[model samples]
Target: MPRRAMLRSAAVAGTAATLSLVPATASAAPNRWTPEELKDRKRVLEAGFTEAEADCWLLVVRATAAFFALPELHPLAKPEVVTAVHVIQDKLMMRPAYRKYRAANP
Candidate 1:
């Protein structure tokens, strides 16, 4: 095969593989505002996130724990769970590199 044709084939194959790894639909996380989340509001505020984001983060943590408790009925792949996990991951990823390094080193 010609070099150009071979490169084009590889690019197409890589693109297809990348597309296959992406989810078909993006689902929104459920709105679950509860008074319980308020207790940690101050801490969250100090950590640079709004009360609302903190509440959602707690909810996601709760949901993830629940899923872990009962894996059969509460699959991690469920839309809400998946959204929660993604949200938590995004939040953690947004943290400063120094903080992450310190946490890892500590």
Candidate 2:
């Protein structure tokens, strides 16, 4: 598999993992989204994002969730960490072979 495909797979896995932790009814329903739900929403948005856009939005979700899940990472003030990761993921998604190779590898 190519490096780009690997990166996209990692991002998708990360996003899926994060989504799994939240209850399905949270954001999909009427109430205001919990912080966790917001984070998940952000992750979904980031997952669909491209590198040219504000890719940091997705990173914010992942980093925030990571910080919440593992306080040891201490991602308190690091708002842009998730964005950086999303940018990397987006770059990988742009590669023509990424999706094809990802399907084959997975």
Candidate 3:
């Protein structure tokens, strides 16, 4: 599969898996998101997304992080894989619904 396609598949699969699990609340200390994740959560909430949407977006973010950590993506010195990974990550930063929220808020 193409790199982008593989990444998309990973995200979709991850989202499905996450949806089946209980979601973590922002106030949950043990389940607290990373600092960067907290920032993203705040941004999405302020952008008018519902709690559920923010949760899903965070899951997508996590899914991409896992994808990047895969063994296949090793050897960061490879020019082609590095460029592809960058492009994929940039696109994944905002899902379509998240974009709509930001656009509406802006």
Candidate 4:
């Protein structure tokens, strides 16, 4: 197998091994995007993003904040996450205010 495949397999195995150690119950629930967060979604439009764009921005903002705080998620993705946030910010800022206004109106 290629090195990337090997690493992925190892990572999968590590995850499985880690998971098996945990005592789980059927009462455990998966994370769900709450109605509160959905209502909070429009707050991003204030910063000049389309509805779809705002949702994407919110996803990255929430995910990175949660991801970096969890040591279990490895530190390697930090730089990429920061770069993605910065790229989105710069892309939005470079657009004409009219463009942002149009996006906001819809």
Better of 1 and 4 by lDDT: 4
Name the lDDT value of residue 70 in candidate 2.
Answer: 57
Ranking by TM-score: 3, 4, 1, 2
Report backbone clashes per prediction: 0, 3, 0, 0
Q: Give the best candidate by TM-score.
A: 3
Better of 2 and 3 by TM-score: 3
Question: Which regions of candidate 1 fall more than 4 Å away from where they truly are?
Answer: 1-40, 71-87, 92-106
lDDT of 3: 0.60
lDDT of each residue in 1-106, candidate 2, tens digit only: 9855665566657755764554453333324446775565555546554332223333444455665575444443244435545665555456535755788999
lDDT of each: 0.51, 0.50, 0.60, 0.53
Residue 24 alpha-carbon offset, candidate 2, angstroms: 6.9
lDDT string for model 1 (14-98, tens) is 5335434432321122233345555554566577664445544565556466665774653424554455466454754365455
Stronger candidate by TM-score (3 vs 4): 3
In the predicted model 3, the residue pairs found to clash are none
> Which clashing pairs does model 1 show?
none
Off-target runs (Cα >4 Å) in candidate 4 are: 1-40, 72-80, 93-106
Tens-place lDDT digits, model 4, residues 5-99: 56555644553354344325211311334676656555656656665555544555565577578765655455555555565555554554768
